[model samples]
Target: MSGKSGASEISLKQSLRKIEYPSSAKDALNKIVDLICGRITSIKNMDLALDLMAEFVFLEIDRRGHKRGFPLTPLIELQLIELLYEYFNNMSNESARNTVFLSIFSGTTAIMRLGVLTKLVSVAIAIPSATILSSASAWMQQLGNTSQNSCKLAEGLIQDYFYFYNPNTSSINLVPSISPQFTANFLTAVTENYFNFTKRECIFPPKVLMESVTTWVSENPGLCIAAQQKQAVLPPGAIAMEATTPIAGLLRWTVLAPINKQDSQVYGDLHLALLNSIIEIPKVTPPKAIYAQHLTGPINPILSYVNDLRNKQELKLDQILNEDNLQLALDRYAQAIQVIYSVNAVYGHVDDLFHQLKLLPFNKLMSIVISTYKKNKVIIL
Candidate 1:
């Protein structure tokens, strides 16, 4: 092992010598592949070498145009994909996984930054595993001090994961097992990024976001349940709104969008989870109520929309509604109630809404909402 390690180090050093700053894209990519394939025994050494190589690659690509500098031929993309697959499939060490994820993220981001649209699909399809996904999630959560390039790369990789993987099919079943913390961290990062990005840029393609959230909620039931419990104790106010708004947006988008049957089921599950969490926020107390009242300013518009929808003939109490429409209605109702709670205002008419909802024959959907409200009513301290 020592002899092999020593030889690998020598090979790596030699490979590094061949790479020049601002080198042509083709040369840089070749050197990167060689360094990654070098027989290094230490994962740490391998990670360090890959990080440096990825940084150099990004710099070189940035220095030159995509078509002229780093023309991503099919062969080159295939090589990068193979390298990523080998590293992710073989390495279980967290640091190693983190390193590889960052490296691949950098490489993919270069492709995106250069407007190389065609190659992105290959990269995305090549790199979706439990280890990579979880490690990337953890890395993203801790990137408070990272470079803009690193941040962009991380975001691009996550967006790719959602774009390429469908939640309802056999392919989704292949998603590797991630821990509860991993799920929570991943969801938090995505939600925060979604809000931040939308504020300054166009909304993330809703279809992609929908698919990703559906997959995540389907796979991470335990984490979702834990999140629900956590939200239950939050005093209704601006802080609660900050956390819940993105979740409610996700639920509302999925509920309203046109999706296939499988995704519809997945979205329904997510819808239920969000509703349960919204109901879990503890009733406001004292000074918090004062701040909450200020936040209630925006609730009126949402309430008006809800009342308009409530009077729709299709949504009548005795009418049998389509499953998708029912879920959509429930989601809207949940959003309005959530906003009201965030402001610490008493929604005296919610019981009437609940009664009408219960009168609908959709037992599965209404039962959960009814039970959640009843449980909240019983728990006065």
Candidate 2:
């Protein structure tokens, strides 16, 4: 199923990327949105439409870096919400719902690119919050098997669209034309709405929070860069697994390193816990993640070696994480994380997670617990 979805996604993105923008970027974007939204007949088609929208925006940004940002005119706003509404209304098709929601993440990344390029940043998404929230509520009421993925995606989409507070100026700089208090109140309302839905609170902090965290992580050599060491000989029939991103590199230490590596059941339990945490469900009734069980065996022994130096007290905190020792620990682990995340769909950029963790003065961890009503769970480091 995923293989077919991947092929379709690739084909759609390629088709869109190959188109030459003979006209202005705004005109091209308008035409593409119109064409894509007009063709939305089924839930699967929503993914294709979002893919086309994202790829065109990406291509525009690539061709002309920060030249002109696309404006979210009333027409385009209506078209986008209408397209999303189509998917939300027909979300009973579980497979299609899952596939299209993943596309929302990619679509969001494209919009965020536009957000950074624009001088008055909120031009990326100008849709009214009430329209989106009401549509979601209506969808939930109509469907018997309400798609939780839809809720997650919708909440994330709205949050990202309006996440434009500028901490440096102590004001809303994303859309300077609007009232700062209006934007702040809008965010507060959106946050409360989702808290009611998910039954846990998460702040849409200033965009500068993410920026500051990423920059700090990137600058710290010991934290971001992997260490150099002679490759260790793996046991017979074992292959290597490497971390793909700096964020994943950090997780290898903070989250994965301290675990009892010889235990597949422990990894399975960990995977299950993480899944339950994301879906905001009770731990005792957590959903099964068979993929994690399948991959944990190969990952165990290699991971056992990841903390050898630390176990011996030979390296400091940063020194242990600074090295690429977690290379074997990340690939399959990261893949498992992605699958579990997709299965029990949670919103927010995965990369932003590590930065948020870094933002804590003592590397404190924040857990959004379902048990907590209108509050976030904080774990001190």
Candidate 3:
């Protein structure tokens, strides 16, 4: 692992040296693609190599102010999509397959994190062809099985669309307006492809899915909020339902059927904290009509699952309030609270759930919670 990390760092440094500012993003993209392909063949740790390459490309785009010049031409977008497909198709080992999948995800995530994924989305919409969207759908379908790794891949794609396409954020204004119907269709397809893999047996613990859902909700607040809206007109036989039902079921199984008392307490507390945090965030006025419709079927169900768990007798708050476990529990609770605050900050809101700390009976727990709140308060401000 260390060797792979070292090699990936060296490759990133060398590839970054090839990029120059105030250059065409088109040409820079080509060079980076070549770098990624070259490293894939020679490197034992293809995942790290791909991740670094994607990160480098994202950073370069930011540094070069390429948002306006980004090659969104159908040909360029199609070529990148084809390259991704070819890489996935050619992989023969688990390592290679995982590498390619995660690398693409990491790359997409990098752009999204940098708030540049919306640039690509605008460019994609400029072209008449649905080839890029269709190609991504096909690639996701090819992931083969539902597991923790596959879940991550699905989340990555979902994150890309939700963040870039979401209306609540300023990023949505960067592109030409897309019809609500078009948004619905795209989300339906994305959800369908994601659920296809999620239906398979999972090898990891159920907590993994819970954590994944939590992370998704935290990171993509606009998407989650939009999903809660009513989409009055979905195409017949749309798969938008997949988003909510499966996620709700997953949460139910994970929360209600905990593997043990200790696990249940930990998960139960986290769920409660997450629920409280979500509720504490002040709501904003809905985005305009065109951007209002979202495929957030999972949000309500996940909330219900958490509420149900909170009502159950098994969730004894006092059990987890003891001195030995109090610190860990407070840490987890604070982390959940942080996710809510982070989302709020992005969307122009300020609310905290420190009031929820009263649920704990122990004074030490309250003190820890107060201290944690103060620490995060400084960070958020």
What TM-score, over all chains together, does every model reach?
A: 0.44, 0.24, 0.27
Which runs of model 2 end up more than 4 angstroms from their true locations?
1-24, 39-254, 257-381
Output the better candidate (2/3) by lDDT. Answer: 3
Candidate models: Cα lDDT each: 0.43, 0.34, 0.38
The most accurate candidate by TM-score is: 1
Candidate 1 lDDT score at position 211: 57
User: Between which residue pairs do clashes occur in model 3?
Assistant: 227-296
* Cα displacement (Å) at residue 124, model 1: 8.5
Model 1 score (lDDT): 0.43
lDDT of 1 by residue, 1-381 (tens): 878967875665456547553343335444444455445434655554554454444333232223345555656555554544454556655554444444445444534532322233224335445554454443433342123433354355455555555434533223424334334444444443442322466244355555556655554444432322322111112132112123433443443433212245545566666555444445544312112222222233333434555576445634434445445554555454554444453333546555554543344544665677778778952
Error of 3 at 320 (Å): 39
Candidate 2 least-lDDT 10 residues: 223-232
Q: Assess candidate 2 and give its TM-score to the true structure.
A: 0.24
Model 3 regions lying over 4 Å from their true place: 1-19, 22-28, 35-40, 44-56, 60-104, 107-114, 138-185, 189-381
Q: What is the C-alpha RMSD of each candidate to the true structure, in Å?
A: 12.1, 19.3, 20.2
Off by over 4 Å in 1: 1-68, 103-128, 143-167, 173-220, 225-248, 251-269, 277-381
